[model samples]
Target chain A: MEESSLLPPVVLVHRPPALDFIDEHLSRHSFTALYTHTSLEDSLQDFLSSHAASVRAVVSLGRLPIPAEFISNLPSLEIVVCASVGFDHVDLDECRRRGVVITNAGDAYGEDVADLAVGLLISVIRRIAAVDRYVRSGQWTRLWDYPLGFKLNRKKVGIVGLGSIGSLVAKRLEPFGCIISYNSRNPKPDVPYAYYSNILSLAADNDFLILCCSLTDETHHIVNREVMETLGKNGVIINIGRGGLIDEKEMVKCLVNGVIWGVGLDVFENEPEVPEELFGLENVVLSPHAAGMTAESLNNISEVAIANLKAFFADQPLMFTVQLD
Target chain B: MEESSLLPPVVLVHRPPALDFIDEHLSRHSFTALYTHTSLEDSLQDFLSSHAASVRAVVSLGRLPIPAEFISNLPSLEIVVCASVGFDHVDLDECRRRGVVITNAGDAYGEDVADLAVGLLISVIRRIAAVDRYVRSGQWTRLWDYPLGFKLNRKKVGIVGLGSIGSLVAKRLEPFGCIISYNSRNPKPDVPYAYYSNILSLAADNDFLILCCSLTDETHHIVNREVMETLGKNGVIINIGRGGLIDEKEMVKCLVNGVIWGVGLDVFENEPEVPEELFGLENVVLSPHAAGMTAESLNNISEVAIANLKAFFADQPLMFTVQLD
Candidate 1:
């Protein structure tokens, strides 16, 4: 405790077990890592007030919003190092005003997240989850007429964001002979896939729409009912991005009314609590916000987050910096 | 009925609703397609006896065994046009002895079958089916720690065969960062994947094994108890080939005993009847034998099988000829 108190540039943490370093890595650099809520520990305000201006860095380990009220407590905070790819939870406006630099787990979990996205799409379209249940229930013995699934070969897939995750999915699906097209914030040069300025045109021409865009105010509910209607009865929607990217209520109605064929969701608008109506549908595949929770990716995230902190304390260039609003 | 009887060189079929033409193709070709068993079906011997020496071909529509006795009954049969890829059900020795030609549905369903193989592997490793059931059963509402899945990044995958379907699978998994190696009857010089002359070494090194070889006498039960043991508790097996290629009884035992991690099976030693023990396992994903049964592939099979039959009648080189034992 005496040695840790002498360490420079104290770093505030949300908690441990959610995220942590290897101990030796932090000790070698000599930085004080203070965790906030460690099993009946002090409230965030009390801890922040006690430490005050000494806490120049905050290591965010969870997906809860860091609003103005919370940031106001840590007046001397200079940097926020996030342990996730999506940072929609963080208040960008407040961070920008305070001149707080931000860094995220960039391209570290990209490969693993992309793997789950393709896996989810294949699961929904192939009816793997539904058919597995059928076989487990001894229905295979009684039934010879199992429903056939649509082939991935030559099917058109529309990508919402052609960033790291979307590009990886495109690279993977190309070998299966699927035609790739996308709609993005702006058309990317040097990408051979067709690009549409409008999302509706992208939906009308493709059999599958995969949402991989970052969630922002301008991008909220980007895939609403009208876009889904154009994708039609044979279309499928797979969401690996934030749930707010889609109009979940209308999407549920589309699934129920057969306006769209099926869906595979990993995130929800209100999560740990899914829409109760989606529970019984055979055409849907649901996962509880676990697309990026693989053990390997978690380790990579810890390493990346630690590296950014080390860089910031030494007054060096960051590994990655989020674009402030 | 009178006009149909006047057509030449009768072709015997197992039954209707199996495989057929869309009226115009057969009408243009001017051939008699006789379906032996309809609602009131005749015995195989009785029907063959009635057709006598005029039955010039047999269009195999199902996976039912074509024993030596059945081939002897159709003495005038010049060719057997099968509508499926795997000819394990056909009596290849009997066909060879009787001087009958055999043509299978070659490479037509390769893309679709390959698609399912990748799907099943992802579904098993990611626990897509198990978690899907949990989500549907209202378990997500409780404070439950959902299990995390392994990532596909930089994992080694061993392929059992490096043929059409196997090659396609390797191609698909490459962008996922999975290293591909293989076991085949002989090493293919042109293939880029590392060659394993023996399967034991392949199993030892890889985290996942994908079985995609054809079933034959020399290859039966290639993945036996010893191979499964070497694959170890963390290894996953994905079988898109014939069921007999694996000893199902031993596999069930290995799964029960935790010798291997998980299995994704589409084919079985006994069709329409899976082992009852697998019904309770959460780590397994079972699909009915619908890997190559996509609507698009079915159309391709019908066209190719019909073409082979037409080529046999016209004394032209066959589209494909199975190498008889």
Candidate 2:
């Protein structure tokens, strides 16, 4: 094969240092690469107009929203690679229609997300946020009226999704002396945790149910009124994954009625605008969707995104190609 | 020994359900116990005035500030047993001058305080407080660029004062994959942690230096500028024992100048009033002297307090006796 035809030029639209890794790897393979650091709102037309002739693919980390018009305009763009797991911002159908391959950096943030998940779990169960607020407000003249928060040790933890992130959550919780049980599409390999085939069954048996699975048509709002009721009055629900995986209204009702002891939510059904009712509740601990926002996860996502982009251009097996029929 | 001659009437300042254990234990003897949920400020005078003839000693939970005048008034109060480790609130010198025996619940709250010490250490290092704030503030959007928190795994943790709480901290940190080292007056038993034997040397070698020893005359202001300077820029100092263990003025200067990565303080020299300067600092996490404020600890303290009171009255060996020369 001729060297000229062997490799194609690629453009990465993410942050540098991470892109530097891709640049270094691609240099070894004799491929021409153009790196562009652009914001999501910036006109992609300018970049396409300047580098469309040589740009074979675009690897992005929130630099561009893969819209239908953007996909159609990039004549030479063969693939759109996201440096993150969530593809809600991408126009997947349009990319499929244009025959532009889409890949995402999935499971790259599993450990980081899982760490946040367990951290949130411990924070909420231990009433750390409430205690901190009390101390900060100067209301801690004496010991708190309520008992110190409960320990995570020996509590039964139910995982809603036993995917990579869920498995990692289990691994972290395991050291805390929790008995782990998980609900998923199918049972995972030789794991130590007990697998529950149903969410309600899992919730009933566990003190906490953590949401770590992906949001899909089948998994959407999997935790509803029945599941919350099954989780009982002593149960806590922690959602570090997509908010759509839980029913917010139902959760509020359960929380208010003491069907659940508390909730720690990092992701809500709607971003930025969360339910105002969740604000003052001492039992609830809420975070803006930032469970996977650690620096380590960012680096992991960026590295994975670059590798996927590099692998696609090299005609090798791409790490995380999104299937499109 | 004659049972009636050996027995004495005791007055309990505060009574909880756990006192039943002590009552039951003492019932085997011939001691007369009078329990009351008295207000420390006013009821002590009334109880002493009414029961001075019958009352032989007083058992307390350390909630009452036993003044010298009150001790002078109690003609029948031969011993004052405190159900807490710290006896600073009590007039120890007064007791010694008046020939009144004083016993403190020293080892009772050890495990509980140790638990809180480890909890604060993990909470601060993992950015649990900040993350909780982020969630409740409703500003959670991108996980990236929010906070660059680190995991507790694979870090060098130094403990000052390898006493009960210090040893417990080491045990807890051991499971979290941290290399534990300590400085103490004397080395501890068969533990795997490296004993530094010197405070500055311990702080220099570790990522986190936790103050868990006593704040005696010798250990007061041990974590001063020179020791902190040895800790360098990447170090974190946690004070869970006493505020006097670290010089707050020097700590503020170091924190402002980035001399250390962060500080987690459960105890302050003049707390319930935290230094106003520490309020806005992003590197520090503050608590209002609550390292031993867990519900379990409270119950444990109360139970042990009752036991000590009962034991003193029955002429049995008191569980925790503070010696006064």
Candidate 3:
């Protein structure tokens, strides 16, 4: 007890300058920052080499990558607590190789992401945003002729990767009379919805495709030109999943040529740099990669991350630990 | 049978030039327009006097009022077929006094209006429309600081008038983890949600108030300043019902002063002329009275109106007949 009181465990926080959400809540821990400002390149190696042995756990914030090279420097690192739902930014293989455990934000963000997915779908189908512009600009008064939007009821909705977020989306959409289906690696026994082993069949049968899968080598660019072609002219695509899951160039072209009906994108292949072509088109609704972000959800995420870190320091079981295999 | 075949019942269509949806489908029966090219003033009295005896049914299109004066002119008018869900535009007392049966669009618009109500709720809470604007205006790259929106999960949702549209709204919100309650003239026996006898009590208890009631004498200005005050600063109001359902002036003040959280208005007291003050606010999402204007719903509305007219002519039971009692 005397030794423990004298020396508290160290936690290394690696985050972008804008994401200092954990600083206030992490007061109990003996913490060190690897990068305080924008440029992590100048002091990253120096900080890692000096504080390598003392750091017991690293808190990765936002989507900043924690690659193999970064993991190799932290020899005493016992766990990586990611403050996000998607841990694709973290090197799972490296962490597993070093016998390091990883815990993600888990269901902390499931409802929020699912909420955004549903919002985007309805917005695109109903032309909520487009008509908003019309009303705001006083075009409604002048023209009195606004184009009619499509209905969401009984439309075939295909969810890609029915994980925690995707499942929540399906449940929320059920009462709207949407015929829900999915494309996943394997079908679960419990769910009532039809499952396709591949993306093409799912796209071909559905009126709308909602992407909720994680980004990985096998899953990256899963929604390409062919998958969209099969989805056809009347189909709509909604991506609340990672940007890498879709081929952005092909999507833009398809939208331009009317190969697909429309899309609602919260994530883009190159974020904060959306294709300029989308700006002129009324069919596409673009968001600034804000799915999984809300005041309550952010608070929940910080609490989960802090709790996981606290649990690790106390030698207790971690929450939402990732299966490395 | 020979007389019926020789001279079909004449139906009077009193509608604006733009609302000629029934023209193509009404060829089966003899239909005459009161006004063809936007000059109803020129021919209304002449048309009414000339065809009063022959006109068996009046197909009231859009919200053009069928007042007591107009009802008095049509001496032989047996029924008023409203091609809209709401029949407040038709004088109920006069219709009842004259033994004129009234039929409305009924459940044709139930799903679409409910969909828009939910869409507006999510859009207002999540800032979906605002964020889309931010992304479109190239502000996302410059600021990197979009304001956080509130979560919808577990929110206390109070629905006004738990009828067809309100019931569907409540049903759709259930799976999103929203706690549902409602304000109605009487408690609905079949619904599982909690009931509030008045708007004030409902507003006081809930985080979100969705107005789905008809605009009648009892419901006009239902959401006044006092109601908004009771709803508090964190509360949101979504009105897909009608502009008259709320006191628009007070609502504008509440939004401007932050007396309430935000609003999503598809209807205004004077539509096509939304309050200029609401234009600059980020919290309010304005829609152009288009909640029931989806293409599918429009088609459904037309079909239902036509079917009801056919049934009335055939002396079969009418569909969606409004109870005069």
Q: What is the TM-score of each candidate against the true structure?
A: 0.87, 0.81, 0.89
Model 1 clashing residue pairs (backbone): none
Measured against the native two-chain assembly using Cα atoms, what DockQ does each of the candidate structures obtain, in the order listed? Answer: 0.51, 0.29, 0.55
The C-alpha interface RMSD of every prediction is: 3.1, 5.0, 2.1
Better of 2 and 3 by TM-score: 3
Q: What are the Cα lDDT values of the candidates? A: 0.82, 0.72, 0.86
DockQ-superior candidate, 2 or 3: 3
**Distance from true location, Cα of B150 in model 3, Å:** 1.6
Lowest lDDT 10-residue stretch of candidate 3 chain A: A30-39
What residue pairs are clashing in model 2?
A: A148-B295, A286-B135, A287-B135, A288-B140, A293-B143
DockQ of 1: 0.51
Q: What TM value does chain A in model 2 reach?
A: 0.82
Candidate 1: Cα lDDT at B214 = 83
Candidate 2 DockQ, CA atoms: 0.29
Better of 1 and 3 by lDDT: 3
Candidate 3, after superposition: displacement of residue A49 in Å?
7.9
TM-scores (chain A) of the candidates: 0.88, 0.82, 0.89
In the range B1-325, model 2's lDDT, one tens digit per residue, is 2553555565544333333334554455455666654344557568667766666666665244667876777776678777667877778888888787777767756655665566566566667677667656766544233455666667899999887778877775665557988899988788778988889888878889989888899999999999889999878888888899999999999999988888888788876668778777666677666555545555566567667666665578876677876
lDDT of 1 at B223: 91
Provide the lDDT at B233 for model 2: 89
Q: Write the per-residue lDDT of candidate 3 for residues B1-325, one digit (tens) a residue.
A: 4574356667788776666667776875555434423446567767678767777788887677788988999888889999887788899999999999999887887888899999999998999999999888877752347877899998999999998888999999999999999999999898889989999999999999999988889999999999999999999999998898889889889998999999999999876688888888999888888888777787787778788887887789888899999
Write candidate 2's Cα lDDT for A1-325 as tens digits: 2763555565645443323334554566545656554433556577666766666677666433567766666777788777767766777888777788888877766665776676677667667667777766656554334335665556899998887788877876664567998998888899778888889888878888999888899889999999988888888999988899999999988888888889888788976668877887888877666565555556667567667766776688987788876
